[model samples]
Target: MAEIPANSLRFHVQRLPGHGAGPAVVFLHGLVVDNLSSFYCTLAVPVARAGHEAVLYDLRGHGRTERPRTGYDPGTAVRDLAALLAALRLDGHPVHLIGNSYGGTLALHAALARPDLVAGLVLIEPPLGGDWVANMIDTLSVAALGLEDGTLHSELTTLRRRKAARLAATADALLNRTSLIDDIAASRPFTPEDYGRLETPVLAVFGEHSELLPGARELARHAPHATVRILPGLGHDVLQGGTEALRHAVLERLGAVAAV
Candidate 1:
């Protein structure tokens, strides 16, 4: 893990160099309780093996990244991504973005905010426009904040032990201390016009049983260049056992990007 300063914060980053000269493929994991490790153990290595530089970083306030009390909005997230890419000199070229869960939300917002930095997008179970965004945000916030009862760490310590206890603590800090939840609630959701105006090619994957399936469909219907795929027997956690499928989707998207 590398520690880099970008957007005035120190972020934990991991990079896997690829064999080919194709555009880099950056992976972004979900919110609280998630860090670069999720992709580091799964897609990052595979993407690098497939000859695309894979960049993974801990989002602000998560993992080893410096956690501040404010600046948790979508705009701040996009700025962090932009600044990180620029700090690494990866901003000189367009890169493919593969984002899971809330990270996918950042990817979408980033592409909209800085189209020049993005080549394509691979969104796994993205929370799309409308009430989907509202509900997703509510669900995640409630789930995480529910741990603030102070019993969560003990419960996890009893089950999965120290590791789970640590995760619970992280969740506790993020939900109880930071302005993350309020920022998310106040942030703007993607409108139909946002998708209709989007020109970036997108490959959005959703599990057959995932509640995010509707959002993927809505994205496909509005985005001029978008494809939606439904993987059977999966849910919000597509990166868990669905790594192979997600890998194929990412590689296939890269191929399409290369052909362009």
Candidate 2:
């Protein structure tokens, strides 16, 4: 684990260096309360072992990355990613992106903004509509209130949960004290025209019961070269519950790209 200066902020980055040949694969995790640890533990090592350089980074205001009071919008997130990749000397190469949840939305935005820099995409249960932001804000607001009133702390302590309590505190600070919710609400959702214009290959994975299934279907309709996979008995947390399936889908996509 190391910190790299990108977009004038320090970003915690982890790299699993592979043989100098295969395409570089970068993992982008979900929104607040999430970090690079999930991908680092589940997919990064496997991808590196598969002969591809795997890179994982904590998004700004998440994990060990610097948390500024502002700049949590999708546009800023995209810029941060561009700067990070450039700082890592990955600007000249086409990289594969694997994004989970909100991270997937950022990946799509990045690919649309700069097609030459992205070779392919693997989006896991990506929420597309603008309503998601509103929903998230409401949910986080409730959680923050619970944390503030001691209800959440009491429950966690009663259950002997240390990590959960710590995470809850962190989430509360990020949601209630920062501009995260506002930034997300202010973000521009991609129009159908945007999706229709993408020529990059996309592999979209959705849980069978996920609310974002419509987004996956819409993506397939717009992106001509997209492949959609729905995992059975799963929901929004496909990255956690469907790890093996996600890994296989990612490897297969990478292999197909390499063969091309």
Candidate 3:
């Protein structure tokens, strides 16, 4: 992971240059539970192997990046992304954006805000409704505020107390950044009106068994250039088990988009 200074903050970014002359693909990880390393370990290798550059980064306060109390919101995140890409000299390049969950949301907002910077987008299960928005925020707030009766507290306590095992605890602590979650929950939902304006080609991948699949399908339906790829026997972590298959699927979609 390489730490780059941008937008008055520091972020940990992972970049893998591809063998070919294709445009680079930038990856964005899911919520507090996932980071750039997770994507690097799971997906970036395949992208790199496919002769495409892959870049992954940890959001503010998530991984090795410096965490700030404020400016974790979406607008700030979008600006931060623009600044980071500019710092990396990817601002005007036709770069592919791969966002998982919250990261996906960030990608959408970024693409909307900076269309010329995005060549294509791959969104993996972004929350689609107000209910999810509220619940996620509530959960994160409960944790950040250190509420004993909240889910975050209970989960963190379990993780720390060894009742949840050390690996699980590490995962929780690594993935669950209270500030990020709260920021999302406090944010608004993506209305249908939002999709009609998106010009980028989007590949929406969702787990067949994931609760968010229906929303993902709805999003694909609305996006004129969107398509859905469902991974059977998988939930939120669809890319976890059938990694090779997922990588092939992603490469295929990216290739198809490049052809068009």
For each candidate, what TM-score against the reference? 0.95, 0.94, 0.85
User: Model 2, 1-260: lDDT tens per residue?
Assistant: 89999999999999999885967999999987898999986788889989999999999899889988888888888899999999999989999999999899999988998888899999988887647667777876776676666678568878989888777767776787778888887877767788899878999999999988877878888887889999999999898899999899888899899889
Better of 1 and 2 by TM-score: 1
Candidate 2 RMSD to the real structure:
1.7
The model with the greatest TM-score is 1
> What is the C-alpha local distance difference test score of candidate 1?
0.87
After superposing candidate 2, which stretches have Cα over 4 Å from the reference? 149-160
Candidates 2 and 3 compared: the better one by TM-score is 2
Superior candidate under lDDT, 1 versus 3: 1
**Model 3: per-residue lDDT, tens digit, 20-52?**
777789988776546687788678988898888
Tell me each candidate's RMSD, in Å, in order: 1.6, 1.7, 3.8
- Residue-pair clashes per candidate: 0, 0, 2
Model 3 weakest 10-residue run by lDDT: 163-172
Candidate 3: C-alpha lDDT: 0.76
Give the Å error, residue 184, model 1: 0.5
Error of 3 at 52 (Å): 0.9
